[model samples]
Target chain A: VEFGGLRAHCPEAALHAARAAYLAGCQATSNVEAGSRFGIPVSGTMAHSWVMAHMDELTAFARYTAVHGARSILLIDTYDTVAAARLIVSAGLRPAAVRVDSGDLAGLSAAVRAVLDAGSLQETKILVSGDLDEHRVAALVASGAPIDGFGVGTAVTTSADAPSLSGVYKLVAVERESGMVPLAKLSPGKRTVPGEKQVWRVARSGETQRDVVATADELGPPGGVPLLRRLMRRGVPTESAPALDAIRDRCRTAVAALPDGVRRLTDAERFPVELSPDLDRLSRRVGGRDDQGP
Target chain B: VEFGGLRAHCPEAALHAARAAYLAGCQATSNVEAGSRFGIPVSGTMAHSWVMAHMDELTAFARYTAVHGARSILLIDTYDTVAAARLIVSAGLRPAAVRVDSGDLAGLSAAVRAVLDAGSLQETKILVSGDLDEHRVAALVASGAPIDGFGVGTAVTTSADAPSLSGVYKLVAVERESGMVPLAKLSPGKRTVPGEKQVWRVARSGETQRDVVATADELGPPGGVPLLRRLMRRGVPTESAPALDAIRDRCRTAVAALPDGVRRLTDAERFPVELSPDLDRLSRRVGGRDDQGP
Candidate 1:
């Protein structure tokens, strides 16, 4: 959403929704067109840029809402966010939500909700989006900030905490005149398995742990099933993937199941992934035990 | 051209071309085409990826140059760089240059250059590409490393040292019934001057230190000119951007007279960039001042 600039420097949940609604307008045609192909949701939200573009906060809200409709989300923090919330509630038009991008979001949320309830607009949602990743989101939910959604940016795009994924694109197998041949790379410190690969993630009855990976052409099967599902083949989508709400729910589920090791904030333990005997044998053979590769 | 793949990663003397004759075929056409469009240079050198791809250093070199031709740059630090250099020099068409991605590049460059010279391949250039940016390049050049070019990546793309420029597309001015009206985003910690704006750079009479900057509208007649140039117009490129070589030269020239402030690696001085009197007047009216523009 950040890379797509759906929401940026947003100040209130109302603004978040407003931005998202605005982006929906811009991306609606494209999303409809893309639905015929990959079928993915195009998302966004109103950013502080809109506020800066208008002469005054009231004018910005009125202009955005007039053009975008009551599906609007008003930003509550360009000036005194509490004061602006009063202005928003008095408007009487149902807003998609209110946004809190700065200050103590919890406190502001409570105050804003109280005011909204007093004004009889109890259905309005609250959203938060400022430097939030899974952990922060978890903390916010745990603390009961009333935030219903997020608009993550820099963190999502840059993946700043762990910038580079260890996932590497390598030529594990090569097709010769006869058949496919497996390959591997082994340097002083860098080592990789050779040949086509497969990963079987073994999970406990509930908790996720005890995963074992083996080469696709292994003699014995591993404890779990295949991890690599065919995502795309020959530039075609394998499945419709899923709807936006469904994907978001999956994200919630995945994040909820993350173990303490995987979720730790600092000096944390890493999730263990072991290779099976068959995969080890194949790796050693393809990579060569004696020499550090070629 | 350091960002470019083929601009003599050893730092060419600033070129407008990475002309490959029929003797060479660059990477997947888009890589070269994009380079041409962005004025980036296509660079190549043998790395463990290729070595492991072929599972043999010699095979990797042969295949790479077979496609890339006379520009083949072989990675020599697989096991022993010097030993591999000897092998590369002896077995087949001597590599155009042997790269030492790891270890002391300066020392390795000397030894590699000497070896190549002794073997009568002076045409072979020693190109190095490890973690190098402009500073490192300047340092190597100052120390007289016999390196021919540099293939700088991460630093330039990521702008590692100073990640993102404090760049913002702002609403500087807007058309109104009463002449053009200046605008501003008077948010706390984020105050921008309003209206259609220009940045003028006034260099000292003889030195590189820019003396002053006046908005285009504020420039007094033609005697004391405007310092800023219209870098972009109507969200489009108005001027032909310089080639990588020329851009690099401009960078050198610009940095050379940077007035000892913003150039420091540590507790350095902050370059003085004062606003024009008209700017100050406008800012005062808008209740804003730019210590930095974000």
Candidate 2:
């Protein structure tokens, strides 16, 4: 939800990041424009700079609580984590959460959780952040870190580990006077399939079994559901454009249906994308790779 | 000047990127917003997608020439680099430049240059792109590739290799009723120097010798030029905010003054950022490393 790092990039990038994160199921974003535009909740823990700006860590927490009340999530790792947690309890401030942004997150979260529980302030949550990604989140969860939530930043915003997706937008067909003509790039090591295309997915017992990339004109193989739909006509969006929530729900269902290998945090198996017979034939003909071309 | 990838990020991001690049000595930007905002020239080569969208590559080139005339930079590596170069010369379409977006940039550019020369179209420039960074650009230059210009994307926009800078904003001192009070963070593996600071550069002739970060209030050591100036006061920018062109010129001068190691494409020696004696003493005292703490 924190987009301060991205703000230095540009206002729109930060806003777009917030929108994408909201659409992808993040609970809230710290960017005000995103909150206003998307109707998502806005929340943020205080920064280390804020804590350092005050005379002491306790003073910063107390001042922030006074201003933001229980809604404030006090950042506890500017100087020390345990001392700050103790100070929060001693000051009788029952904030919504205590965030640990540095140090060993697993140990810190556990220690903070135990202190909050012992003080009968079990309602206060423990939120961990700092270089967290899906793999790190899973590791913390597996270790029973007593974390209530996470404040993901860099890793989420930039897709840091795998920063760029291997996505390509090749023109499948060209509009001609007669009809739509298939196009293909036959460069070695960079060949592209020709013709308008659609992907059909096969699911068995709620799990996706396979997918076929085929020509868009066909109804596709039996027992498979087409994954692409016409969403735009000219410059106008069609009725097929679903509401954000519906799209998010559908995305959740689709992701859940994927096999375990594709869902793993690391070394995920590549999902099969088989080309249909029609698509293969069109590709070969337009690419000048047929028997007659030689 | 190419900014298609950034335009896909966000309009503001694209604009800001263009502004930054222009201010960093780039001659022009492909972003129209930047051109309008900063009075910088805008230029671009056609995308492969545009060519693929048409019935054929030649048709696309002809249509683009009819619209853009000699200003057009025809992209030639969509299907085959050599074949497209031959077509360009044969078709009598004299574009300003021919760009290679894929393949061995060095070899392809040389081949394209030779073909253009043989056809007496020697005025055409050779532009190269695709996963290009400083090192790759340097390699092309070192190998004497016929490249006249480059269209750097991902690496520059994302700051990919060193994606994130280890930037921190520690409140060195807080404003109090009587005076400014210095503060410090004493966390293990992370320490902050106490007090307001300024960096002084000691340059000899046209080359930089060293830099010293010291407390702001003091007159820096002899012959050292203070690099930090008062830019703003109480949320209002001071007169110190110069025009972008002036800032750009200053940046160029400063960069030129840097040592050779700092300018090298790889394995550059880290620039020294030493603290002054008083600043060092203050850091030690406030960080509690002067004596062991329990």
What tens-digit string does per-residue lDDT give for candidate 1 at A1-294? Answer: 333232222223223333333233212211222333333444434666676556566777778788767567776665466777788777665677777666676777788888888888888777666656657766777787666666554443333443222344556767655577676554444456766767776656655675677778664343466767788999998888566456556566655665778867666778888888877887777655453333
Indicate the DockQ of the complex predicted as candidate 2: 0.34
lDDT of 2 at A275: 89
Query: Candidate 2, which segments miss by more than 4 Å at Cα?
Result: A1-8, A53-55, A70-72, A164-168, A240-244, A289-294, B1-8, B49-59, B240-245, B289-294
| Native RMSD of candidate 1 (Å) | 7.5
How far residue B53's Cα lies from its native spot in candidate 2, in Å, is 4.9
TM-score between predicted and true chain B, model 2: 0.92
Question: How much native contact recovery, as a fraction, does model 2 achieve?
Answer: 0.33
Q: Which digits, one per residue and each the tens of the lDDT, describe model 2 over residues A161-274?
A: 544444577776777666787777666677788888899998888899899999999768878999888788897988765676877787778888999999887899998889
iRMS per model, in Å, is 9.2, 5.2
TM-scores for all predictions: 0.73, 0.89
Model 1 Cα lDDT, one tens digit per residue, B127-245: 77665767787888978999987766444433234322235566666555555666665545656665444555555653444444444466542334354667788899888866545
CA RMSD per model (angstroms)? 7.5, 3.5
lDDT (10s digit) by residue, model 2, range B106-216? 999989999999988899999888877778989999999989998876665555555444566777777776577777777666677788898999888879978999999
Candidate 2 chain B has its poorest 10 consecutive residues by lDDT at: B1-10
